[model samples]
Target: MEQDNRTAYFYLFGDNEDFGMKSCWIRNLTKAPEEIEVKLMEKGIPPMLTKEFCKFPEGQESLNKKNLEIVWMEEGDGAALLENGEILCVIPSWGGDRGFCGYARDCNGQGGFAWELSEDNEIRKRINNAISFIKEWNEEVNPFQSLQPQILDYYEDIFGESEKYYAIDNSDWPPKGLYVYEGTEKIVFATVAVSLRPQPKVEMYYEDASKVNRIELGIILKSGLTNDEINNIASLISGITAIPWDYITFVAEGHTVEFETIASEKFKYAVLTNKLKLLPEMNVPAFGNSHTNFLWIVPVSDKEWKMMKESGSKVILDKLDTIGEEIFSLERQEVV
Candidate 1:
């Protein structure tokens, strides 16, 4: 097999002010020559560790006393440096506490792998190297794949422009909207449709003058339904239950629409009667006036609604509560 001859550079900085060993360079010469040796040079001290330097063991009391500034070794690359006129030495082999480590540094005579010098040029070089590594890793591991333009085109037709909308990763719900890099910039299309279905406020009222066991369930739909459609829906619901048509009222899109006449022939008709034939499996009814062309009303049991209200858990309810409070304050001239 052919040997890999790629080389990487690591920039090191020193602490000595008088000697000014502030900047130094380490060139990985693993594949260059077998006799290539590692050298550490200081102004006063003699050259230390002049032999073929490959790796060194941990806890070398001699080198520890010298207090090296930077050390990096990985695979076929290795180098070490020191400042303060200290003579640093090392053996040739790849094993120790710092074995196979890529980058290691010291600050104020402290030995560790963390790089803390933000103002130094060496630290900047290391940051650039890290950014390059991240970019390369992203390219190899999480490559940007362009979404099918046709799918985006369809959404663009319905929702207007593609750029105006944001992509959401619905794999996790409540459907997290992806960041620009993770979605739009990366060519990942937004797959979820946005629509307005204002939360329904539940109110209970007496069904009859007698005020017995029967109670009328009034749901105020703040938006997304026409008066006629609400009347038809109310009539249909009345037919299913023993509750009279007069008991049902739908506050559709800010206007109150009540189903008053149960016996009258004029109020018995359903515009979406044929449409309602496809029940249970296909309950979502689309109104032409809807901005999104569809209205989704998820039916929840009274027990579930009560539980959700008690816990303050439903996100839609929370949003609606905030909006209602703001609107109420504005209506009363409390907030200008």
Candidate 2:
């Protein structure tokens, strides 16, 4: 048997950032293909990726409907099952050449306005809601409507000639400040950074048995400076910034390090949402936006945890009521 090389199946939800005011139309891209088949031997059906498949141990009986599994050992050809028992195999065809692409009818009454652009980042937060609304309206859309001319007209206005070097088309109307990279299997959609300035650099570190990469931010005042003078400086910084002084610590380490304040976890969110406008890795696991710096706190063994608490180095401090071990961050701006 000739070997086939294809990636395992992965589901797509569609892209919103690529389309603008009509961004709501993004959700129509999620429906399964009318006919999906793998090439080569052409008879073996693919499996479904359900919750059971992700949970069950790997093997053949694990290939049951409850644990729909697809193996990548053979590459190229793969299969998948629809909820209603329809089997979609890997086959060769024009549409199958570049994987799959299908048109969906707009079921909504808003003049096929299944997808619409949102006012702000509100759409990103309510993506699931948007998908549900569009699915309900897909049945009404006319997939056969001639959109090529309209798409051409939109691009001609921007690039003077819509044939090539154009930014967008009718098939995929990306929103401003969004990028879309569609693949044969999965699609990746991301919101581009809005800042004219370049993105900042970030470094990550995980502590093991002997060393600590986390640094504590401490502010120092001159020895001659009165307590009132120190307090005034502290108040000024706190007011201008979201960093809380209570979260900060004052340590007199000779003249080199005078006053220190531990930056809080809340400031992390504020910096990313208001300043950067991009997601960071550490906070990606959580749904909300990320701050200027990305930091994840992994707990050490209980023995180390107790020793650190008594070390008096102020290695671990809790500002956001983060009960277990904690992590803090600092921003790294480009030098222009």
Which ten-residue region of model 2 has the weakest summed lDDT?
194-203
**Top of the candidates by lDDT:** 1
Q: Candidate 2, 184: how far from true, in Å?
A: 71
Q: Give one digit per residue, the lDDT tens place, for model 2 in 76-188.
A: 11212222232222111111222232111122122121211223423232333323333433555321122223333432342244122212122321111222222332222
Please list the C-alpha lDDT of all candidates, in the order they appear. 0.25, 0.23
Span of ten consecutive residues with least summed lDDT in model 1: 269-278
Return the top candidate by TM-score. 1
RMSD of 1: 25.2
- Candidate 2 wrong stretches, greater than 4 Å: 1-30, 34-213, 236-336
| Clash count, predicted structure 1 | 1
Candidate 1's residue-wise lDDT over 123-143, tens digit each? 344334323433542563321
